[model samples]
Target: MNNEEYVFAPDDFVLAGNDHDAFIDDTYFKQSYWKDMLSRFTKNKGAVVGLFVIFLIILMAIIGPGLNEYTYDFQTISHQNLAPRIELLEPLGIFDGSETMSTSTGMVEINKYVSEDGSLTGLEDTYYWFGTDVLGRDIFTRTWEGTRISLYIALVAVAVDMLFGMSYGLISGYFGGRVDMVMQRISEIINGIPTLVMVTLLIIVMKPGLGTITLALAIRGWIGMSRIARAQVLKLKEQEFILATKTLGAKDFFIIFKEILPNIFGQLIIMSMFSVPNAIFTEAFLAFVGLGVPQPLASLGSLISDAFKSFTTHPYMIIFPVIVLALIMLSFNLLADGMRDAFDPKMKEM
Candidate 1:
């Protein structure tokens, strides 16, 4: 047959690029999971603002104590229950033998000099910025100190929960059947009980202390995390990579740690992020019910409980700490939401 006649019209063989390797490597950079997650996170404006609010709260918590002259233990008998005073930086007039000394505001001379103690003053003094509590301690200082406590409790509790929960979940999920059934049944039993009631009972029996409170909260908090880890492990256990590792004579531990664990790390991180706020809230609730960190330590919930007595007169005491706590909780929730959306497999499908 002639070449032109035998050419199978225009639908014969299609010409394609032979740079498959280059395309695969190049496309990898564009489709990176972390890059996409970060991009999606940054696009969330509310999360960005929440992050800034959290940063500011943390900065204040760290620096506010140093800026104040009074210590958390400092108490002044004469200054007890005194409102903040405004100190003016005006020139003092010198009085001669028969001359009278007077203070002026701005070209206006005052006839009588009245020294008033414990009155509402403007923000010209260092005594109080936000105001004082019933104890006359600086609200600003106490609020920051409270913040440090709350953050510390939340972080520590989450860390402990993650350590125990992730390990339990990994083991249960990697080895199904008996291990999984026993662990999950136990989790269900724990989940069935009221978390608050268990915490209260522990507090009553063990006497509520920081360590006790943290331990109590961690007991129940880990269940959700374990369930999440278990689900992730179940999905990843049968993957091609995991099967390949098994075929290569890799040990179960090696396969679980090296292959399966890495695949579920993202989900674990997102779960941890969501878990932190819960821990903080749990601690706060304990404190509110008098089973939290003891007095003088100043957790947000403790501060709120204390402020409730003087709320009618000194609302700032409650308002300031509540605002700080709200900001922190909001920040964590926003971060969790962002992570959930970013790491969601269904999102990638869309």
Candidate 2:
């Protein structure tokens, strides 16, 4: 058959013209990348649970200590080393246990009474929920307080690291040639030095305090983040969007910060999430080894160290703090994993 004779009818299939307005209208109603990411994150049970746990920890750290009248400064020589008070649940009795007889105004009475020995004489005995530390301070209270320190240090250190690392990485990555080579070499030299040795040297020279410790950690911690960010920028800088921006004569700063940085922000956020746990661990270790925050301000590591001597008798002190620390670390790690999955381009490809 001739080609002309075999032509198909226009009605065989409908044609949808490329209506830019229709496409624009559809896109206007579509969910953004952040919204989709949020939906995906919400569906991740582990991440949701981790976020809940972290929120609870933060809430406890912020509010729990305030519930107590003793502000870690309430002291009594008489109460030192005193065991936690144990109160028993009394069995229900007939007549609602009302044994009130008289009062100063007229004649009022109550079933509960204080003993001459000062023990809770009217109630039955119960176990201490968290027991007590070596100094007889409530382990439960101290644990929450210590949690605040841990989370605070982690957050501050991560912030400092990110600020320095991101700036250095972006500048080096965008500039590439000599600047990149110099910065990368410097990073390598710093990374070559043992982290512990550098930390120890700083502690010795700077006189150990929370600020000094944080600063020391920030120095070593930024290297890995910088390298990761630089690598990301190198790959992203060659993309079409970046090239277009350059072609339009956009300023270097504008292209780097406005275009490139925003695109790689997910990776930066994931890296920061991972960095927090590391900073917390580093602070804890430094404190444990006497190179951490100063005295009177109790960190989990410091509390654990203090409880070491009486660990046999007051194991609760160490146990409680360790549990809190572990929970914080675990939650951070889970959150990091979630972020990694959320940000991973490979997953999107799949």
Candidate 2 accuracy as TM-score: 0.77
Q: Cα lDDT for residue 261, model 1?
A: 80
**Model 2 clashing residue pairs (backbone):** 88-124, 88-125, 100-109, 100-110, 101-109, 102-108, 103-108
Report the C-alpha displacement of residue 298, candidate 2, in angstroms: 0.3
State every prediction's TM-score relative to the real structure.
0.77, 0.77
Q: Which candidate should be chosen as best, given TM-score against the real structure?
A: 1
Worst window of 10 by summed lDDT in candidate 1? 90-99
- Tell me the whole-model lDDT of each prediction, alpha carbons only: 0.73, 0.73
Tens-place lDDT per residue, model 1, 1-350, is 65665537786877776955656665555557778988888888877787788888888888988886876656544344344332331233321101123335333322112224745534223345555666666666777887888888778766865788888888899999998999999989988988778877887788667878777767787888888888889988988988888888999989877888887787788778778787888778878878777766778888898888877544556887888898898898887777767777464353
Per-candidate clash tally: 0, 7
Model 1: how far residue 259 lies from native, Å: 1.1
